[model samples]
Target: MAKSVAPGRPNQFLRNLNSKIACIPMMLTALVIFLGGTVWTVIYSFTNSKLLPRATFVGFDQYERLWAASRWIISIQNLAIYGVLCLIFSLLIGFVLAALMDQKIRFENTFRTIFLYPFALSFIVTGLVWQWVLNPEYGVQGVVRSLGWESFTFDPLYTPEIVIYGILIAGLWQGTGLVMCLMLAGLRGIDEDIWKAARVDGIPMWKTYIFIVIPMMRPVFITTLVLIASGIVKLYDLVVAQTSGGPGNASEVPAKYVYDYMFQAQNLGQGFAASTMMLLTVAIIVVPWAYLEFGGRKRV
Candidate 1:
Protein backbone atom coordinates (compact mmCIF):
# COMPACT_ATOMS: atom_id res chain seq x y z
CA MET A 1 0.00 0.00 0.00
CA ALA A 2 1.27 3.47 -0.91
CA LYS A 3 0.65 6.71 1.01
CA SER A 4 -1.43 9.39 -0.68
CA VAL A 5 0.71 11.01 -3.36
CA ALA A 6 0.60 14.72 -4.26
CA PRO A 7 -0.76 15.57 -7.66
CA GLY A 8 1.74 16.60 -10.27
CA ARG A 9 1.79 20.06 -11.86
CA PRO A 10 -1.54 20.91 -13.47
CA ASN A 11 -1.62 20.08 -17.17
CA GLN A 12 -1.11 23.33 -19.10
CA PHE A 13 -2.80 21.54 -22.00
CA LEU A 14 -5.96 21.32 -19.94
CA ARG A 15 -5.78 25.02 -19.06
CA ASN A 16 -6.35 25.92 -22.69
CA LEU A 17 -9.46 23.77 -23.01
CA ASN A 18 -11.53 26.13 -25.16
CA SER A 19 -8.72 26.84 -27.60
CA LYS A 20 -7.76 23.17 -27.77
CA ILE A 21 -11.32 22.15 -28.50
CA ALA A 22 -11.49 24.76 -31.27
CA CYS A 23 -8.24 23.42 -32.72
CA ILE A 24 -9.54 19.84 -32.98
CA PRO A 25 -10.40 20.11 -36.62
CA MET A 26 -6.97 21.51 -37.41
CA MET A 27 -5.32 18.80 -35.35
CA LEU A 28 -7.32 16.14 -37.16
CA THR A 29 -6.38 17.58 -40.56
CA ALA A 30 -2.75 17.70 -39.62
CA LEU A 31 -2.82 14.14 -38.34
CA VAL A 32 -5.02 12.51 -40.94
CA ILE A 33 -4.18 14.54 -44.07
CA PHE A 34 -0.58 15.70 -43.88
CA LEU A 35 0.87 12.98 -41.70
CA GLY A 36 -1.29 10.30 -43.28
CA GLY A 37 -0.35 11.43 -46.77
CA THR A 38 3.35 11.38 -45.90
CA VAL A 39 3.05 7.90 -44.39
CA TRP A 40 1.20 6.71 -47.46
CA THR A 41 3.85 8.07 -49.81
CA VAL A 42 6.66 6.42 -47.85
CA ILE A 43 4.88 3.05 -47.50
CA TYR A 44 3.85 2.96 -51.13
CA SER A 45 7.38 3.80 -52.22
CA PHE A 46 8.30 0.15 -51.55
CA THR A 47 5.60 -1.06 -53.91
CA ASN A 48 5.72 -1.25 -57.71
CA SER A 49 2.83 1.19 -58.24
CA LYS A 50 2.26 2.28 -61.81
CA LEU A 51 -0.24 4.69 -63.45
CA LEU A 52 -2.29 4.30 -60.32
CA PRO A 53 -0.86 3.40 -56.91
CA ARG A 54 -1.01 -0.42 -56.83
CA ALA A 55 -0.34 -2.08 -53.52
CA THR A 56 2.13 -4.60 -54.95
CA PHE A 57 4.85 -4.61 -52.30
CA VAL A 58 8.11 -5.09 -54.17
CA GLY A 59 10.64 -4.52 -51.38
CA PHE A 60 12.97 -1.83 -52.86
CA ASP A 61 12.39 -2.76 -56.50
CA GLN A 62 11.38 0.82 -57.27
CA TYR A 63 14.41 2.20 -55.46
CA GLU A 64 16.73 -0.15 -57.34
CA ARG A 65 15.41 1.09 -60.67
CA LEU A 66 15.56 4.70 -59.50
CA TRP A 67 19.24 4.41 -58.58
CA ALA A 68 20.09 2.64 -61.83
CA ALA A 69 18.44 5.28 -64.02
CA SER A 70 20.92 7.56 -65.78
CA ARG A 71 18.58 10.49 -65.46
CA TRP A 72 18.51 10.16 -61.66
CA ILE A 73 22.29 9.85 -61.57
CA ILE A 74 22.64 12.99 -63.68
CA SER A 75 20.09 14.75 -61.50
CA ILE A 76 22.03 13.97 -58.33
CA GLN A 77 25.31 15.10 -59.86
CA ASN A 78 23.73 18.31 -61.06
CA LEU A 79 22.20 18.96 -57.63
CA ALA A 80 25.56 18.49 -55.94
CA ILE A 81 27.33 20.86 -58.27
CA TYR A 82 24.53 23.38 -58.14
CA GLY A 83 24.08 23.23 -54.36
CA VAL A 84 27.74 23.74 -53.46
CA LEU A 85 28.44 26.58 -55.87
CA CYS A 86 25.16 28.30 -55.16
CA LEU A 87 25.79 28.28 -51.41
CA ILE A 88 29.31 29.66 -51.67
CA PHE A 89 28.73 32.35 -54.28
CA SER A 90 25.39 33.52 -52.92
CA LEU A 91 26.73 33.88 -49.39
CA LEU A 92 29.84 35.61 -50.57
CA ILE A 93 28.02 38.05 -52.82
CA GLY A 94 25.29 38.68 -50.30
CA PHE A 95 27.69 39.36 -47.44
CA VAL A 96 29.84 41.64 -49.54
CA LEU A 97 26.83 43.58 -50.78
CA ALA A 98 25.43 43.83 -47.28
CA ALA A 99 28.73 45.09 -45.89
CA LEU A 100 28.94 47.73 -48.58
CA MET A 101 25.39 48.75 -47.96
CA ASP A 102 26.15 49.12 -44.26
CA GLN A 103 28.62 51.90 -44.92
CA LYS A 104 25.78 54.46 -44.45
CA ILE A 105 26.03 55.38 -48.10
CA ARG A 106 23.79 58.05 -49.63
CA PHE A 107 20.70 56.99 -51.55
CA GLU A 108 20.80 53.67 -49.72
CA ASN A 109 17.12 53.07 -50.24
CA THR A 110 17.42 53.49 -54.02
CA PHE A 111 20.40 51.19 -54.25
CA ARG A 112 18.75 48.53 -52.11
CA THR A 113 15.59 48.58 -54.19
CA ILE A 114 17.64 48.26 -57.36
CA PHE A 115 19.49 45.27 -55.95
CA LEU A 116 16.35 43.58 -54.61
CA TYR A 117 14.07 44.25 -57.58
CA PRO A 118 14.88 40.94 -59.22
CA PHE A 119 13.64 39.04 -56.17
CA ALA A 120 10.15 40.47 -56.68
CA LEU A 121 9.66 38.33 -59.79
CA SER A 122 8.60 34.73 -59.51
CA PHE A 123 10.96 31.93 -60.56
CA ILE A 124 8.82 31.17 -63.62
CA VAL A 125 8.95 34.75 -64.82
CA THR A 126 12.63 35.05 -64.01
CA GLY A 127 13.40 31.82 -65.88
CA LEU A 128 11.49 32.79 -68.99
CA VAL A 129 13.01 36.27 -69.12
CA TRP A 130 16.51 34.87 -68.69
CA GLN A 131 15.84 32.18 -71.29
CA TRP A 132 15.23 34.78 -73.96
CA VAL A 133 18.24 36.82 -72.81
CA LEU A 134 20.53 33.79 -72.83
CA ASN A 135 19.28 32.50 -76.18
CA PRO A 136 21.86 32.82 -78.95
CA GLU A 137 19.31 33.86 -81.53
CA TYR A 138 18.04 37.13 -79.99
CA GLY A 139 19.97 37.20 -76.73
CA VAL A 140 23.38 38.31 -75.57
CA GLN A 141 25.24 35.99 -77.91
CA GLY A 142 23.42 37.28 -80.97
CA VAL A 143 23.61 40.87 -79.78
CA VAL A 144 27.35 40.56 -79.20
CA ARG A 145 27.77 38.95 -82.62
CA SER A 146 25.99 41.86 -84.22
CA LEU A 147 28.65 44.13 -82.75
CA GLY A 148 31.26 42.71 -85.16
CA TRP A 149 32.18 39.61 -83.19
CA GLU A 150 31.19 36.81 -85.60
CA SER A 151 32.76 34.11 -83.37
CA PHE A 152 30.94 35.14 -80.19
CA THR A 153 29.83 31.90 -78.57
CA PHE A 154 28.13 32.41 -75.21
CA ASP A 155 25.40 29.82 -75.48
CA PRO A 156 25.21 28.36 -71.95
CA LEU A 157 21.72 26.80 -72.16
CA TYR A 158 22.80 24.68 -75.10
CA THR A 159 26.21 23.73 -73.69
CA PRO A 160 25.88 20.48 -71.77
CA GLU A 161 29.02 20.99 -69.70
CA ILE A 162 28.26 24.52 -68.41
CA VAL A 163 24.47 24.56 -68.57
CA ILE A 164 24.25 24.06 -64.82
CA TYR A 165 26.38 27.14 -64.28
CA GLY A 166 24.03 29.09 -66.54
CA ILE A 167 21.12 28.23 -64.28
CA LEU A 168 23.27 29.05 -61.26
CA ILE A 169 23.80 32.55 -62.59
CA ALA A 170 20.09 33.25 -62.83
CA GLY A 171 19.50 31.69 -59.41
CA LEU A 172 22.13 33.82 -57.79
CA TRP A 173 20.73 36.95 -59.38
CA GLN A 174 17.26 36.33 -58.04
CA GLY A 175 18.29 34.93 -54.64
CA THR A 176 21.30 36.91 -53.45
CA GLY A 177 19.22 40.02 -52.81
CA LEU A 178 17.28 38.35 -50.00
CA VAL A 179 20.52 37.09 -48.51
CA MET A 180 21.92 40.60 -48.67
CA CYS A 181 18.86 41.94 -46.92
CA LEU A 182 19.14 39.33 -44.18
CA MET A 183 22.83 39.99 -43.70
CA LEU A 184 22.21 43.71 -43.63
CA ALA A 185 19.64 43.33 -40.89
CA GLY A 186 22.05 41.19 -38.93
CA LEU A 187 24.85 43.65 -39.35
CA ARG A 188 22.66 46.50 -38.20
CA GLY A 189 21.69 44.58 -35.10
CA ILE A 190 25.33 44.52 -33.96
CA ASP A 191 25.62 46.72 -30.90
CA GLU A 192 27.39 50.05 -31.10
CA ASP A 193 29.24 49.13 -27.89
CA ILE A 194 30.96 46.27 -29.71
CA TRP A 195 32.20 48.61 -32.40
CA LYS A 196 33.32 51.14 -29.80
CA ALA A 197 35.17 48.48 -27.86
CA ALA A 198 36.89 47.28 -31.03
CA ARG A 199 37.81 50.87 -31.89
CA VAL A 200 39.23 51.46 -28.38
CA ASP A 201 41.37 48.33 -28.81
CA GLY A 202 42.54 49.58 -32.21
CA ILE A 203 41.19 46.44 -33.90
CA PRO A 204 41.06 46.44 -37.66
CA MET A 205 37.55 46.90 -39.06
CA TRP A 206 37.66 43.73 -41.14
CA LYS A 207 38.95 41.79 -38.17
CA THR A 208 36.14 43.16 -36.01
CA TYR A 209 33.58 42.02 -38.55
CA ILE A 210 35.09 38.54 -38.87
CA PHE A 211 35.84 37.94 -35.22
CA ILE A 212 32.97 39.72 -33.50
CA VAL A 213 30.13 40.72 -35.81
CA ILE A 214 29.72 37.45 -37.70
CA PRO A 215 29.69 35.38 -34.55
CA MET A 216 27.00 37.58 -33.03
CA MET A 217 24.65 37.22 -36.00
CA ARG A 218 24.49 33.43 -36.05
CA PRO A 219 20.66 33.37 -36.16
CA VAL A 220 20.51 35.49 -39.31
CA PHE A 221 23.06 33.32 -41.04
CA ILE A 222 21.10 30.22 -40.08
CA THR A 223 17.86 31.71 -41.42
CA THR A 224 19.55 32.55 -44.72
CA LEU A 225 21.01 29.05 -44.93
CA VAL A 226 17.55 27.50 -44.57
CA LEU A 227 16.14 29.78 -47.26
CA ILE A 228 18.93 28.96 -49.68
CA ALA A 229 18.70 25.24 -49.00
CA SER A 230 14.94 25.28 -49.61
CA GLY A 231 15.52 27.07 -52.92
CA ILE A 232 18.13 24.51 -53.95
CA VAL A 233 15.90 21.53 -53.18
CA LYS A 234 12.79 23.00 -54.83
CA LEU A 235 14.73 23.94 -57.97
CA TYR A 236 12.23 22.77 -60.59
CA ASP A 237 10.26 25.67 -62.00
CA LEU A 238 13.34 27.64 -62.99
CA VAL A 239 14.92 24.67 -64.72
CA VAL A 240 11.66 23.85 -66.46
CA ALA A 241 11.02 27.35 -67.77
CA GLN A 242 14.64 28.00 -68.68
CA THR A 243 16.39 24.86 -69.92
CA SER A 244 13.82 22.04 -69.62
CA GLY A 245 16.77 19.68 -69.07
CA GLY A 246 17.93 20.46 -72.58
CA PRO A 247 21.37 20.01 -74.12
CA GLY A 248 20.96 16.28 -73.35
CA ASN A 249 19.76 16.52 -69.72
CA ALA A 250 22.79 18.45 -68.55
CA SER A 251 20.97 20.52 -65.96
CA GLU A 252 18.32 18.04 -64.86
CA VAL A 253 17.69 18.39 -61.11
CA PRO A 254 16.14 15.91 -58.64
CA ALA A 255 12.78 17.69 -58.40
CA LYS A 256 12.41 17.52 -62.16
CA TYR A 257 13.35 13.85 -62.09
CA VAL A 258 10.67 13.14 -59.49
CA TYR A 259 8.06 15.11 -61.45
CA ASP A 260 8.89 13.42 -64.71
CA TYR A 261 8.66 9.95 -63.19
CA MET A 262 5.39 10.65 -61.38
CA PHE A 263 3.47 12.60 -63.99
CA GLN A 264 5.11 12.00 -67.35
CA ALA A 265 6.45 8.47 -67.01
CA GLN A 266 3.32 7.29 -65.10
CA ASN A 267 5.39 5.38 -62.55
CA LEU A 268 4.03 6.36 -59.16
CA GLY A 269 6.29 3.89 -57.38
CA GLN A 270 9.43 5.29 -58.95
CA GLY A 271 8.32 8.85 -58.31
CA PHE A 272 7.42 8.06 -54.72
CA ALA A 273 10.79 6.41 -54.23
CA ALA A 274 12.61 9.38 -55.69
CA SER A 275 10.64 11.78 -53.53
CA THR A 276 11.18 9.67 -50.44
CA MET A 277 14.87 9.69 -51.21
CA MET A 278 14.69 13.49 -51.29
CA LEU A 279 13.09 13.47 -47.83
CA LEU A 280 15.86 11.16 -46.67
CA THR A 281 18.48 13.42 -48.21
CA VAL A 282 17.11 16.37 -46.30
CA ALA A 283 16.90 14.27 -43.16
CA ILE A 284 20.27 12.53 -43.45
CA ILE A 285 22.37 15.27 -45.02
CA VAL A 286 20.77 18.58 -44.06
CA VAL A 287 18.89 17.86 -40.83
CA PRO A 288 21.96 16.82 -38.85
CA TRP A 289 23.99 19.80 -39.96
CA ALA A 290 21.15 22.14 -39.07
CA TYR A 291 20.65 20.45 -35.75
CA LEU A 292 24.31 20.83 -34.93
CA GLU A 293 24.35 24.40 -36.12
CA PHE A 294 21.19 25.83 -34.58
CA GLY A 295 19.43 23.15 -32.55
CA GLY A 296 20.98 23.61 -29.09
CA ARG A 297 19.91 26.07 -26.43
CA LYS A 298 23.35 27.66 -26.58
CA ARG A 299 23.47 30.96 -28.44
CA VAL A 300 26.34 32.45 -30.37
Candidate 2:
Protein backbone atom coordinates (compact mmCIF):
# COMPACT_ATOMS: atom_id res chain seq x y z
CA MET A 1 0.00 0.00 0.00
CA ALA A 2 1.18 3.63 -0.69
CA LYS A 3 1.82 5.99 2.24
CA SER A 4 -0.48 8.99 2.63
CA VAL A 5 0.69 12.61 2.91
CA ALA A 6 -0.43 15.08 5.65
CA PRO A 7 -3.75 16.79 4.80
CA GLY A 8 -2.89 20.51 5.36
CA ARG A 9 0.91 20.63 4.85
CA PRO A 10 0.78 20.73 1.07
CA ASN A 11 -1.96 23.33 1.12
CA GLN A 12 0.00 25.49 3.60
CA PHE A 13 3.13 25.21 1.49
CA LEU A 14 1.19 26.23 -1.61
CA ARG A 15 -0.30 29.20 0.30
CA ASN A 16 3.15 30.39 1.37
CA LEU A 17 4.51 30.07 -2.11
CA ASN A 18 1.55 31.97 -3.54
CA SER A 19 2.06 34.77 -1.04
CA LYS A 20 5.73 35.09 -2.02
CA ILE A 21 4.77 34.99 -5.68
CA ALA A 22 2.27 37.75 -5.16
CA CYS A 23 5.06 39.95 -3.79
CA ILE A 24 7.31 39.33 -6.80
CA PRO A 25 6.14 42.41 -8.75
CA MET A 26 7.03 44.81 -5.96
CA MET A 27 10.38 43.10 -5.37
CA LEU A 28 11.21 43.22 -9.06
CA THR A 29 10.26 46.89 -9.32
CA ALA A 30 12.54 47.83 -6.44
CA LEU A 31 15.36 45.67 -7.73
CA VAL A 32 15.10 47.17 -11.20
CA ILE A 33 15.16 50.74 -9.90
CA PHE A 34 18.00 50.20 -7.44
CA LEU A 35 20.21 47.88 -9.45
CA GLY A 36 19.55 49.60 -12.73
CA GLY A 37 20.53 53.03 -11.45
CA THR A 38 23.61 51.69 -9.67
CA VAL A 39 24.75 49.80 -12.76
CA TRP A 40 24.27 52.83 -14.95
CA THR A 41 26.30 54.98 -12.59
CA VAL A 42 29.09 52.37 -12.40
CA ILE A 43 29.23 52.05 -16.16
CA TYR A 44 29.37 55.81 -16.63
CA SER A 45 32.16 56.04 -14.02
CA PHE A 46 34.42 53.80 -16.13
CA THR A 47 34.15 55.85 -19.35
CA ASN A 48 35.72 59.10 -20.55
CA SER A 49 32.24 60.56 -20.64
CA LYS A 50 31.38 64.28 -20.56
CA LEU A 51 28.14 66.30 -20.81
CA LEU A 52 26.65 63.34 -22.66
CA PRO A 53 28.06 59.93 -21.85
CA ARG A 54 30.46 58.39 -24.43
CA ALA A 55 31.16 54.67 -24.93
CA THR A 56 34.94 54.99 -24.55
CA PHE A 57 36.45 53.26 -21.50
CA VAL A 58 39.09 55.27 -19.58
CA GLY A 59 39.90 52.84 -16.78
CA PHE A 60 41.03 54.70 -13.58
CA ASP A 61 41.95 58.05 -15.10
CA GLN A 62 38.95 59.83 -13.52
CA TYR A 63 39.78 58.37 -10.13
CA GLU A 64 43.36 59.65 -10.43
CA ARG A 65 42.19 63.16 -11.34
CA LEU A 66 39.70 63.10 -8.44
CA TRP A 67 42.47 62.11 -6.02
CA ALA A 68 44.67 64.95 -7.25
CA ALA A 69 41.91 67.58 -6.95
CA SER A 70 42.36 69.83 -3.90
CA ARG A 71 38.73 70.92 -3.89
CA TRP A 72 37.63 67.31 -3.58
CA ILE A 73 39.78 66.85 -0.50
CA ILE A 74 38.50 70.11 0.99
CA SER A 75 34.92 69.06 0.33
CA ILE A 76 35.45 65.76 2.12
CA GLN A 77 37.02 67.46 5.13
CA ASN A 78 34.22 70.03 5.26
CA LEU A 79 31.65 67.24 5.15
CA ALA A 80 33.22 65.60 8.20
CA ILE A 81 33.06 68.81 10.19
CA TYR A 82 29.51 69.59 9.14
CA GLY A 83 28.28 66.03 9.75
CA VAL A 84 29.68 65.78 13.27
CA LEU A 85 28.44 69.20 14.33
CA CYS A 86 24.98 68.67 12.87
CA LEU A 87 24.61 65.27 14.57
CA ILE A 88 25.71 66.52 17.99
CA PHE A 89 23.62 69.69 18.01
CA SER A 90 20.50 68.04 16.61
CA LEU A 91 20.61 65.21 19.17
CA LEU A 92 21.25 67.48 22.17
CA ILE A 93 18.59 69.99 21.25
CA GLY A 94 16.07 67.30 20.33
CA PHE A 95 16.54 65.47 23.61
CA VAL A 96 16.07 68.63 25.64
CA LEU A 97 12.96 69.70 23.71
CA ALA A 98 11.39 66.25 24.01
CA ALA A 99 12.06 66.04 27.73
CA LEU A 100 10.57 69.44 28.35
CA MET A 101 7.54 68.71 26.19
CA ASP A 102 6.82 65.57 28.18
CA GLN A 103 6.22 67.54 31.41
CA LYS A 104 2.44 67.85 30.76
CA ILE A 105 2.79 71.58 30.26
CA ARG A 106 -0.09 73.86 29.28
CA PHE A 107 -0.80 74.14 25.54
CA GLU A 108 1.31 71.07 24.94
CA ASN A 109 -0.30 70.43 21.58
CA THR A 110 0.43 73.97 20.40
CA PHE A 111 4.03 73.71 21.48
CA ARG A 112 4.40 70.36 19.77
CA THR A 113 2.99 71.75 16.54
CA ILE A 114 5.25 74.76 16.68
CA PHE A 115 8.34 72.68 17.19
CA LEU A 116 7.40 70.22 14.44
CA TYR A 117 6.39 72.81 11.84
CA PRO A 118 9.95 73.27 10.65
CA PHE A 119 10.22 69.63 9.59
CA ALA A 120 7.37 70.14 7.14
CA LEU A 121 9.31 72.71 5.14
CA SER A 122 11.84 71.80 2.47
CA PHE A 123 15.55 72.27 3.21
CA ILE A 124 15.94 74.52 0.15
CA VAL A 125 13.48 77.03 1.53
CA THR A 126 14.98 76.87 5.00
CA GLY A 127 18.47 77.34 3.62
CA LEU A 128 17.42 80.41 1.68
CA VAL A 129 15.94 82.06 4.76
CA TRP A 130 19.02 81.21 6.78
CA GLN A 131 21.26 82.70 4.11
CA TRP A 132 19.41 86.00 4.30
CA VAL A 133 19.52 86.05 8.09
CA LEU A 134 23.22 85.26 8.24
CA ASN A 135 24.43 87.47 5.43
CA PRO A 136 26.87 89.96 6.95
CA GLU A 137 26.04 93.02 4.86
CA TYR A 138 22.29 92.61 5.27
CA GLY A 139 21.50 90.27 8.13
CA VAL A 140 22.76 90.03 11.69
CA GLN A 141 25.69 92.22 10.86
CA GLY A 142 23.55 95.08 9.55
CA VAL A 143 20.98 94.62 12.30
CA VAL A 144 23.64 94.86 14.96
CA ARG A 145 25.20 97.87 13.28
CA SER A 146 21.81 99.50 13.13
CA LEU A 147 21.52 99.00 16.87
CA GLY A 148 24.56 101.27 17.23
CA TRP A 149 27.13 98.51 17.55
CA GLU A 150 29.66 99.25 14.82
CA SER A 151 32.27 97.11 16.55
CA PHE A 152 30.15 93.96 16.20
CA THR A 153 30.92 91.58 13.34
CA PHE A 154 29.48 88.16 12.42
CA ASP A 155 30.58 87.06 8.95
CA PRO A 156 30.76 83.32 9.20
CA LEU A 157 29.65 82.53 5.64
CA TYR A 158 32.50 84.50 4.14
CA THR A 159 35.11 83.19 6.53
CA PRO A 160 36.64 79.90 5.46
CA GLU A 161 37.54 78.63 8.91
CA ILE A 162 34.09 79.34 10.38
CA VAL A 163 31.69 78.89 7.43
CA ILE A 164 30.97 75.23 8.23
CA TYR A 165 29.67 76.22 11.67
CA GLY A 166 27.26 78.67 10.07
CA ILE A 167 25.86 75.92 7.86
CA LEU A 168 25.65 73.61 10.88
CA ILE A 169 23.50 76.11 12.73
CA ALA A 170 20.95 76.17 9.91
CA GLY A 171 20.97 72.38 9.55
CA LEU A 172 20.46 71.90 13.28
CA TRP A 173 17.51 74.26 13.25
CA GLN A 174 15.69 72.21 10.63
CA GLY A 175 16.69 68.73 11.89
CA THR A 176 16.28 69.07 15.67
CA GLY A 177 12.51 69.10 15.38
CA LEU A 178 12.46 65.65 13.76
CA VAL A 179 14.57 64.22 16.55
CA MET A 180 12.30 65.86 19.15
CA CYS A 181 9.25 64.22 17.63
CA LEU A 182 10.90 60.79 17.66
CA MET A 183 12.12 61.17 21.22
CA LEU A 184 8.74 62.50 22.37
CA ALA A 185 6.97 59.45 20.99
CA GLY A 186 9.48 57.27 22.78
CA LEU A 187 9.00 59.21 26.02
CA ARG A 188 5.23 58.94 25.85
CA GLY A 189 5.36 55.18 25.28
CA ILE A 190 7.37 54.71 28.47
CA ASP A 191 5.55 53.06 31.41
CA GLU A 192 4.00 55.62 33.77
CA ASP A 193 4.50 53.35 36.74
CA ILE A 194 8.26 53.74 36.42
CA TRP A 195 7.99 57.48 37.01
CA LYS A 196 5.62 57.03 39.96
CA ALA A 197 7.86 54.41 41.53
CA ALA A 198 10.89 56.63 41.21
CA ARG A 199 8.98 59.56 42.72
CA VAL A 200 7.86 57.43 45.64
CA ASP A 201 11.49 56.49 46.24
CA GLY A 202 12.43 60.21 46.41
CA ILE A 203 14.38 60.13 43.17
CA PRO A 204 14.76 63.56 41.58
CA MET A 205 13.13 64.22 38.23
CA TRP A 206 16.45 64.87 36.47
CA LYS A 207 18.01 61.74 37.89
CA THR A 208 15.04 59.62 36.81
CA TYR A 209 15.16 60.94 33.27
CA ILE A 210 18.91 60.59 33.08
CA PHE A 211 19.04 57.03 34.43
CA ILE A 212 15.68 55.36 33.83
CA VAL A 213 13.99 57.15 30.95
CA ILE A 214 17.01 57.51 28.68
CA PRO A 215 18.17 53.94 29.14
CA MET A 216 14.72 52.58 28.31
CA MET A 217 14.64 54.64 25.11
CA ARG A 218 17.65 52.93 23.52
CA PRO A 219 15.80 51.71 20.43
CA VAL A 220 14.38 55.16 19.73
CA PHE A 221 17.81 56.69 20.23
CA ILE A 222 19.30 54.25 17.75
CA THR A 223 16.56 55.02 15.23
CA THR A 224 17.16 58.75 15.52
CA LEU A 225 20.91 58.24 15.07
CA VAL A 226 20.39 56.25 11.89
CA LEU A 227 18.04 58.88 10.48
CA ILE A 228 20.56 61.63 11.13
CA ALA A 229 23.38 59.53 9.65
CA SER A 230 21.49 59.15 6.37
CA GLY A 231 20.81 62.87 6.24
CA ILE A 232 24.51 63.61 6.71
CA VAL A 233 25.44 61.42 3.77
CA LYS A 234 22.92 63.12 1.47
CA LEU A 235 23.63 66.67 2.63
CA TYR A 236 23.54 68.99 -0.37
CA ASP A 237 20.61 71.39 -0.38
CA LEU A 238 21.61 73.41 2.66
CA VAL A 239 25.18 73.81 1.48
CA VAL A 240 24.03 74.94 -1.94
CA ALA A 241 21.41 77.40 -0.78
CA GLN A 242 23.37 78.94 2.06
CA THR A 243 26.89 79.33 0.74
CA SER A 244 26.83 77.85 -2.76
CA GLY A 245 30.05 76.26 -1.58
CA GLY A 246 31.44 79.79 -1.57
CA PRO A 247 34.47 81.62 -0.19
CA GLY A 248 36.40 79.51 -2.72
CA ASN A 249 34.78 76.11 -2.02
CA ALA A 250 35.31 76.40 1.72
CA SER A 251 31.89 74.99 2.60
CA GLU A 252 31.65 72.37 -0.16
CA VAL A 253 30.32 68.90 0.67
CA PRO A 254 30.88 65.61 -1.16
CA ALA A 255 27.34 65.63 -2.54
CA LYS A 256 27.75 69.10 -4.02
CA TYR A 257 31.18 68.17 -5.30
CA VAL A 258 29.70 65.16 -7.06
CA TYR A 259 27.01 67.34 -8.61
CA ASP A 260 29.55 69.83 -9.91
CA TYR A 261 31.56 67.11 -11.62
CA MET A 262 28.52 65.38 -13.06
CA PHE A 263 26.83 68.46 -14.45
CA GLN A 264 28.84 71.69 -14.30
CA ALA A 265 32.28 70.24 -14.96
CA GLN A 266 30.87 67.61 -17.37
CA ASN A 267 33.01 64.88 -15.83
CA LEU A 268 30.71 61.86 -15.40
CA GLY A 269 33.45 59.40 -14.51
CA GLN A 270 34.81 61.42 -11.59
CA GLY A 271 31.31 62.09 -10.36
CA PHE A 272 30.52 58.39 -10.21
CA ALA A 273 33.82 57.66 -8.48
CA ALA A 274 32.97 60.28 -5.84
CA SER A 275 29.51 58.82 -5.45
CA THR A 276 30.98 55.34 -4.95
CA MET A 277 33.46 56.66 -2.41
CA MET A 278 30.66 58.37 -0.51
CA LEU A 279 28.61 55.16 -0.47
CA LEU A 280 31.60 53.25 0.83
CA THR A 281 32.34 55.82 3.51
CA VAL A 282 28.77 55.80 4.74
CA ALA A 283 28.71 52.00 4.84
CA ILE A 284 31.91 51.91 6.86
CA ILE A 285 30.54 54.32 9.44
CA VAL A 286 26.98 53.03 9.60
CA VAL A 287 27.28 49.26 9.16
CA PRO A 288 28.99 48.71 12.50
CA TRP A 289 26.29 50.67 14.32
CA ALA A 290 23.54 48.81 12.46
CA TYR A 291 25.09 45.45 13.33
CA LEU A 292 25.38 46.34 17.00
CA GLU A 293 21.84 47.66 17.15
CA PHE A 294 20.24 44.70 15.38
CA GLY A 295 22.51 41.67 15.76
CA GLY A 296 24.32 42.19 19.06
CA ARG A 297 22.83 40.94 22.33
CA LYS A 298 21.00 43.38 24.58
CA ARG A 299 23.00 44.90 27.40
CA VAL A 300 21.72 44.55 30.94
- The whole-model lDDT of each prediction reads 0.92, 0.88
By summed lDDT, the worst window of 10 consecutive residues in model 1 runs over 1-10
Mind giving the per-residue lDDT tens digits that candidate 1 earns over 1-300?
123333675566577899999999999999999889889999999998888998999998889999999989999999999999999999999999999999999999998998899999999898999899999999999999999999989989999999998899899999999899999999999999999999999999999989999999989998999899889998999999999998888999999998998999999999999999988888897877967766864765
Off by over 4 Å in 2: 1-19, 297-300
Worst-scoring 10-residue span by lDDT in model 2: 1-10
Could you estimate the TM-score for every candidate?
0.92, 0.90
Question: For model 2, how does the per-residue alpha-carbon lDDT over 186-261 read when each residue is reduced to its tens digit?
Answer: 9999999999999999999999999999999998998999899889889999989999999888999999989999
Candidate 1 achieves a global lDDT of 0.92
